[model samples]
Each structure stands twice: as C-alpha cells, then as structure tokens.
Target: MRLAVIADVHGNLIALEAVLADIARFSPDLMVNLGDLVSGPFDPAGSAQAQMALGCPTLAGNHERGLTMNGANGLDALARPLLSPDQLGWIAALPATLTLLDGAVFACHGSPAGGDEEYLLEDMSTGRPRLDTEAAIRARLAGSGGAEMVLCGHSHVARMASIGGVLVLNPGSVGMPGYRAALPVPHVVEAGTPHARYALLERGPGGWSAQFHAVPYDVETAARQAERHGRPAIAHSVRTGWMPPA
Candidate 1:
C-alpha cells in the first residue's frame, strides 16, 4: 500500500495546493490529512472545502479541538468565525487518531495517549524541540495498540525513526513551516525553508518505508494573504519558513 500523509495545514490553501499537486505525481493509493486543518490567517473556509472534496480520512489536531471544543487558541479564534456550519461539522467529526491497513499503520496528530498536545518524538524540556530518547519514544507508543508503523505530526518537522523495529514518522507541516510555541516552554520550530511538506509511505516485503517531500509554492502570495489579514509574523514565516524576531 502507498499512503500519502499531510498534516498541520493551518489554512494556507496555497501551500496545501502545492503539496497536493506534488503528491499527484506519485499517484498514491491513499491520502490522509493529520489535521490542524483550518486555523490560520489564510482561507480557512476554502481549505476546509478543499479537504472535504478529497474525502480522505483526516485526523484532528490540537487546533481543531480549540475551534470546535472551546479550547483557547488565538488562531482558532481567528478561523472559527470564517468557517460555515458544514466546514465546522466536518472538522468536529474527525478522529484524533486512526488505524489503517488492518492495524499495520497508526496515524495520529500527536502521541497516542497524550492526545493532540504531547510530542511523541520531541523532547521540549530543553527549551527547544529535539528528538527524544528511544526508551521515551517507546513509552509514548505503549498505548499505540501495537501498530507496526506510527505516523504523527504537530512538531511540523519531517523526521523518521525505527525503535524496536517499529517505524515512526512525522510528515512535517503542509501549511505553516515555523512557529514560536509558548506554554510548557517558549521556543520556536522552523523548517528553515519555504516549502510545503508531506510524506509517502510504502509497504513492501521488507516492511514499511517512507519518503519525505518538500514542494515549493508561491510563498510571496501566501505571505501577502497573511499581511492583508493583519498577521505580519505569519507573513514573514510563510515567506522565509522562520518566525520573525520577537
């Protein structure tokens, strides 16, 4: 089975379109979105519509909870008003995690039990995002229900690892590439390039393997949309894939 995974599409339709076009080149058997779908400065409603048209299995990210379940997030607040009832309902119906290929593949926006807030592969205690230890990663996967391959997003960093023969993958972000996260600790996550990211996973006799893709789009156009929406920081991030200086 060949699966194309996209995540953290924080409403940048431009980036999402670019990534989708690139994914078409491979003609994947399945495509799934890992959420954070419509909570950003650009085209939240349109983004929702586009994903709905695809009719793929989509998992909800933390932002989806904020928008529909009353979690406090500024981006959610910004996007909530723009989405119509159908769009809102579609997001609200998404599962936080999904199991596919009859349990061979597990897909979630974050860690299995930690829901949408925890970082399964990242250790943020050091005031930045870094790969966590193998033991720690295993502990996080203890609740994954024994899926052979785990797919997660939210760190917005494309990375892959194999622990105890279990493959773990993060397909990176499809929309915003970087952001300064605040809460458990203040730090920034940057991809260091203005490109839309995704991953293609294929299963063979050997096992499952993944390939990451970064597709270029009209960065200036995306940035200008952010600017017109009064989000200069987002504009800068879209153009350069790095957050503006605080």
Candidate 2:
C-alpha cells in the first residue's frame, strides 16, 4: 500500500496546492489528512472547500473542536467569517480518530487518549517540546494496541517514532510551517525553512517504510497574504520559518 499523509494545513491554499501537486506524482493509493485544516489567517473557506472536494479521510483537530464546542478562541474568531455554519458543522462532525486498513493503521490528532490536545511523541514537561523518551512515548500508547502504523499531528513538526512495533508518524504542517505557541507553556515549532511538508508510507514484504518530503511554494506571497489579513507575526514566520524575536 502507498499512502500519502498531510496535516496541519492552517488555511494557506498556496502551500496546500503545492504540496498536493507534488503528492500527485507519487500516485498514492490513498491520501489521508490529519486535520487542523481551516483555522489560520489565510482563506479558511477556500481551504475547507478544497479539502471537501478531495474527500480524503480526515480526523478533527483541536481547532475544529474549538470551533464547534464554543465560539471562543483566536482561531474561532478568525475562522467564523470564512466558514459557514454548515461547513463548520461538517468539520466538527469529523471523528477524533480513525482506523484504516483493517486495523493496520490508526490515526489521531494527538495521542489516542488525549483527543486533539496532547503531544503524543513530544515531552513537554520542561515547558518546551522535545522528542520524548521511548518510555514516555510507550506510556502514551497504553490504550492503543499494537497497530502496525499510527499517525498523528497537531505539533506541526514532522517526526517519526517507533514504539512497540508500531511506526508512529507526524507529517508536519502542509501550509503553515512555523509559529509560537503559548498554551500549557510558551514555545515555538519551526521547520527551519519555508517548505511545505508531508510524508509517504509504503508497505511491502519487509515492513512499512516512511519518507518525508518538503515542497517549495511561494513563501513571499503567502507572507504578504498573512500581512494583508492582519497577521504580521504569522507573516514573519511564513517568510523565514522562524518566529521573529520579541
């Protein structure tokens, strides 16, 4: 099986289109989206519509839950005008998790238990996220049985971890590449370059092998779009893939 996985497309259609164009060359058997789809300074409605047109399997991210559970938070404020009630409802109705290939693959926005909030493969005890220890990752998987592959997102960082014989993968951010986060603690996640990222998984006789890819897009144009949308911080991040110093 050849699967293409994308995640955290926080509403930048340019980057998303670029990444999707690249993925087409692979001619994947299946394409999966790990969510956080339309909650950014970019064209949220357009992004949501594009994803809807693709009809790829998806899981709801925390932003989706926030948009549905309450009319609060910065994301909801920015997203409301862009997405209609029906569109938002459609996104909210997405399941928090999904199992595919007859249990060969399990996917979630965060950990299996944490819904869309926790960082399954990152240790955040020190107020910043670092790759968690093997033991720590294993503990997060306590409720998740031995699935051959597990996919997750929400960290916006591309990573892969092998725990208990399962290949855990995060395809990272397809649109927004960097941002400063200030919940639970203050920290930043950066891809160190303005490139759209995703991952591919292939199953063969040996086992499942994973490959990460970064596709070039119009970073300057994206940054300008963010600025025009009144998101200068995000504009800076888009241009450099690193948050500007305070």
Candidate 3:
C-alpha cells in the first residue's frame, strides 16, 4: 500500500497546494493529514477548508485545541479571531489521535499520550531538537500497540525512526517549514530550505519504507503574505526556512 502523509500546514495555502500537486503524481492509495492545519500568518480559513475538502483522516494539532480552549500558549492567537464560531467548534471536535487500518497504523499529532503538545520522536528539553532515545520513544508509546507504523506531526521536521518493530514517521510541514518554538525551551526547527515537505510510505513485505519529498513553491509570495500580516519572523521562515537572525 502506498500512503501520502502531510502535516503542519500552518496556513500557507500556496505551499500546501504545491505539495498536494506533487503527491498526486504518485497516485497514492491514501493521503492523510496529521494536522496543525491552519493557525499561521497566512490564510487560516482557506487552509482549514482545503484540508477538510480532502475527506481524509486528519488529526487535530495543538493549534486547533488552543483555538478552541483559549490555551496553547497563545500560538493560536493570530488565526483565532479570523475563524467563525462554527469553524472553531469544528476544529475542537477533531480527534487528537486515531488508530487506523484496523490497528495496522496509528496516527496522531504528537505522542499517542502527548495530545498534540509533545514531540513524539524529539527531545526538546535542551532548547534544541534532537532525536529521542529509543527508550524515551518507547516510554511515549506505552499503550499504543498493534501498529506496524506510527505517524505524528507538530515538529515541522521530516523524520523517521524504527524501533521495537514499529516505524514512526513525521512528514514535516506542508506549509510552514520552520519556527522558533517556545515550549520546554526556546529553540528553532528549520528545514534549511523554503520548500514544502511531505512523506510517502509504502508497505512492503518486510515492513514500511519511507521517502521524504520537498516540493518547490512560491517562497517570495508566501513570505510577503506573512509580512503583510505583521509577522516578520514568519516571513523570514517562509522565505528561507530559518528564523530571522536575532
């Protein structure tokens, strides 16, 4: 089976469209979104609508919860007032995690127990991103069993880890590729290039093999859009996939 995975769109519809176009080339068996769909300096409403139109299984990221719960450490602020009450309610209703393919795959925004706030494969306590130890990842998956593959987002970093007979994957960001995070410790996550990203997974007889793809898009337009919204930081990241030099 061929599966296309997209995550952490963060409201840049331009990038999302580009990635989707590329994903179509392979004619995937299924396409799934791991969430953080809207909530960025770009068009949040449109981004949310685009993801919803796919009719695919989409998980709710922390921004969705924050938009509904008035928490999320203010991450949802810019996009919150832009959405209507109904839209906000819809986001609130989305599940944070799902066990799919009759337990052959587990999908989530973060760790199975992290609820969109934790990094499933990354340790952030050091003010930077690093792969979590196998033991640490196992601890995060204490109760998530029966899945040959696990999918998660929210780190905006494309990565994969095979441990304890499971392949854990993060497809990276389809919209915004980098951001300076504020939780656990203040640090940056950057792809080092202003391109959209996604992952393709194929279930082979042995297991799941993965491929990370970076799709080109109009970086300048996206950067200017963020600038118009008064977000220089996002503008910088949109252009170069790195935070503005302090």
TM-score result, candidate 1: 0.97
lDDT (C-alpha, whole model) for all candidates? 0.90, 0.86, 0.86
In candidate 1, what are the lDDT values of residues 141-161, reduced to their tens digit? 877787999989999999998
lDDT of 2 by residue, 75-114 (tens): 6578867797878878978998888888889888898866
Q: What would the TM-scores of all predictions be?
A: 0.97, 0.96, 0.95
Which runs of model 3 end up more than 4 angstroms from their true locations?
71-75
Lowest summed lDDT window (length 10), candidate 2: 68-77
The candidate maximizing lDDT is: 1
Instruction: For residues 115-186, write the lDDT of model 3, one tens digit per residue.
Output: 688899999888668999999998787557878889999898899998888889999998887788778688
Answer with 1 or 2, whichever has the higher TM-score.
1
Error of 2 at 149 (Å): 0.7
Number of the candidate with higher TM-score, 1 or 3? 1
- Find the 10 residues in a row with the least total lDDT in model 3: 66-75
Query: On a 0 to 1 TM-score scale, where does candidate 2 land against the true structure?
Result: 0.96
